[model samples]
Target: MIKHLRGVWISCLLILGVGPSAGWAGVDSDISSSRYPSIQAALDANPGKVVEVAPGIHEIHDTIRIVTAGGGLVGSGRIIQMDPARPIVRIDHASGATLRGLTLTRPEGRRETESEAVIATDTHDLALVDLRVIDNQTRGAAIELRNCVDGQIRNCLVQNYQRVAVDDRTATPDQGFAFRCIIGTGILIRECQGTLIQGNRVREDRLVATPEVKRQHGLGQIIKKNAVRGRIASQRDWDRGETDNWMQGTAIHVGSPETTDNTQVIGNLVERAGQGFDIHADHVILSQNIVNDALVGMKAMHGSKHVIVTGNQFIKNTLWSIGMMPGASSLPSRAAQGGQPARAANVDGGSIIANNIITDFGLGQTRWIWGEENVGCPIRFDHGQVPENPPLVDVIIQGNLVYDTGRDTLIKEGKPEVVPPRYRYAVLVESGPSAPVGLHFSNNLFHPGVRGISNIELKP
Candidate 1:
């Protein structure tokens, strides 16, 4: 039986003191210092220890809390060089800790709002290998997991988060801006579960920090400006009165449900980011990623269900690169509509959006699948509104490849809007009365030139 379950998982890690030679008490309790006077006294004299930080610069002012629960803290070939502006390391309430090959920085203005160079909370089985979180001014989410769970943020190299690097929020305030700023969103799983944010390199193009709006007389508006030109670092700003000012900043903002199922955002390389990867979790799995640019490169709103965004690579996002905003309209229309009749009426199910590769160079090369009714205009779903019962549902644009720049690829229905062109096999089936029942557009590949396949039948 697999070696008796690996000898009962190493005898429950030697009764929980996390055995592997319990807390190394050798080499004169090694605690090298170029400047970390006391990172919780070098992790409480190295509990479940293995400290050996050597590569220069180490200036932490406070907050390196590690409440080792089942003991296990190793830092092989270390290099704890911090002070990019503050927040060196703060892994509060720890568990099976493992932070390998470190190198975190942060100088200029000592970054603010609890500056982060590393911050985990109410921890769990954590593991962050091959680390290198650099250039910190305001956000370089090198590592920031709050209210943690079974974690594993592997092969890291989170870069210059002058704003947000790897932040994972828990105490939901509308579940927005969880990992804001930029460096890389290599790994950011919120409210956490069996997490694993593999192979990292999440980059962002600054211009974040716009929060402080409370208007409606209560007055608090701050919108310090940032449509995408610069300076944006505000966290949260509430105002549900609606004016189409629903901001949610991101680079990986997976909030909602303080604990769902097994989470996995496989093979990473998410670049830029004014907004990219904003999943709300629920049996997640965003495989083989390499999303570039950013304005919207994979946004799965609130009611997120059995998710599975396969073989990814949606480049040059300026808008609609893979969206699904099932907000408002009550909610439970099979949990925001998708496929399998929202999973046979159970409500929220469908989400297989398979075999990906959506590219768009710039200037109106839009429409890569927006929500609601799948509006057209560089993509705009929820914006089209619809979902009172079995009303909204029509998403299963199979086998991908929506490459445009040579123009022509508009698929719309209803409201005097009918614009179509790029057709290498068009199949717009919307057989009325509540539509949606296995809407598949089989084996796809639509380049700018076109081929042969047109079967339009709208009118819902």
Candidate 2:
């Protein structure tokens, strides 16, 4: 665990003649919404007490900043925005503070940058619990924790945050820079230590942010027992295209590069997303998670080290399930984007991929993605390409079950140019930078036969 951030402070303002928006209890320790004009007014009192909001719509002007510590912000009502461009709440430079039972909705037609509903940065000993951000406005992140330690987001439900909410449709999914920068995640933990994000649901809406960039290293964070599903769409999106657009969000994207270490992703169900667990960190563990119905299930992009992908299920994914490619090709700018990093960095250290269930659609699982060739396999490594990237290191693939794979695993016949499909391969390791430093394979199970697994230096 990293050290806690300390000695951080933000100045608070006391709006004198300008009273709180509503009623004010005008007391300390225990405050009520009707008693205060606005939620920010109660927080400004600095009584170190619980501020309870009534069951109604509380509109605010500025970002409600928390500069003091040791209090609670509890509301059974909704916090709407008078200024849609600004955030709803911000928790900073405070500890032992609790934000619970609140529903914050962003307004429509925000012309400014991406906006987050709740953000906690550089704080400790905080808890965000039982918050329902429902029918949320566009560009909504229920909670975003940055440089925060000893914080937890528990039992929260953030639903129906549209990806983009402007009048123009200039940016398509192909031009995904806006999505990468928007505050569209259910929860985003960046450059934090010892954080626990448990029992949260980020459902509906086909919009998200991908930190595939090389910043914000996360440490000692655990994302467990959460359900990140994109099976349903908004009424507006459903009218445009049904399942075609419903399953189009990235469930979880971890980007630390060298900063994030020893992070754990466990016991989560990610379904109907465009991508799942797109990771670019080191010493990460992805275990006991369910990844299904996506273009790419999981990936180690740009560059990574010491990743263990085990005890998981990759089922019915449209394209290659797991891939090891430079992330340069996956970001907003690619080789074609002039100066942008084309792929992720290089990979190093020993890794393990074991004891997982990887399934294919027998013969009918064929789709072209990102303008790539059609594929019906679970695992992929760059095969026999030129040696431009760094050499891949030691790998061990063992004790995994493969079902109905070979039908689309390989080319069927002799022409070699026009190839047909066959149920032949389960794993494909082709031209890498160089021969792997050490490669081992053992005890793999194939459902139909054993013809498709290829390119193993050391075989079972």
* Most TM-score-accurate candidate: 2
Backbone collisions counted per model: 30, 32
450, model 2: CA deviation in Å?
A: 12
lDDT score, candidate 2: 0.57
> Per-residue alpha-carbon lDDT of model 1 for 1-460, expressed as tens digits?
9999999999998777676444432212245432345545656766666355545555555545556754333343333434443466667676776666666665555543346666677788887766776654443344668667888787677654543333433233333333222233334556778788787776643433223222222222232322332112233332321212222334555655325456887887866564567776667888888767665678665556667778888776644566654433224424435555443222223666678887643322222222122232222233212333242244455676766543544344533432333223222333344334443445656443232333342122
Q: Each model's TM-score?
A: 0.31, 0.63
For each candidate, the alpha-carbon lDDT, in order, equals 0.52, 0.57
How would you encode candidate 2's per-residue C-alpha lDDT over 32-123 as one tens digit per residue? Answer: 76777777777677456668877888878788877677766876778876686677888887777788878877555552236777888788
Taking all chains together, the TM-score of candidate 2 against the true structure is: 0.63
